[model samples]
Target: MWLEQMLAAAGRSGAFYEGKRRAGQYFLRYELPRTEAQFALLESLDRTTLDMPADCI
Candidate 1:
């Protein structure tokens, strides 16, 4: 969806297209993989949060 939008924007402006293209590539390369680790960490959460001692708050 975003790539399609970026490509559409390329038809409108070169600079805007390049910027979005580079940003999207960066996100896909560097940021996308973080979701796996983040989701795994999230999945590890069980009752620990809810069971925390009231005094800690």
Candidate 2:
């Protein structure tokens, strides 16, 4: 699941131009591990939090 999210973000980064010339631009490449342990480790650093109102629950 975490890997999927990472790949999706990577895809949104756009394409890569090796020898093309540009004024001032850059491209980043994101690589995610394919192992469950790796995903767990990555997710542990950035866990999400949910907030609910007192009367909502």
| Highest-lDDT candidate | 1
TM-score of each: 0.67, 0.20
Off by over 4 Å in 1: 1-7, 10-13
For candidate 2, write residues 9-33 as lDDT tens digits.
Answer: 5534433322121211222223323
TM-score of 1: 0.67
State the C-alpha lDDT per candidate.
0.77, 0.41
Q: How many clashing pairs in candidate 1?
A: 0
CA lDDT, candidate 1, residue 44: 89
Worst 10 residues of 2 by lDDT: 18-27
Give the per-residue lDDT digits (tens) of candidate 1, residues 1-57: 656666666656567778887887787788888899879878988777799899998
Off by over 4 Å in 2: 1-34, 46-57
Candidate 2 lands at a TM-score of: 0.20
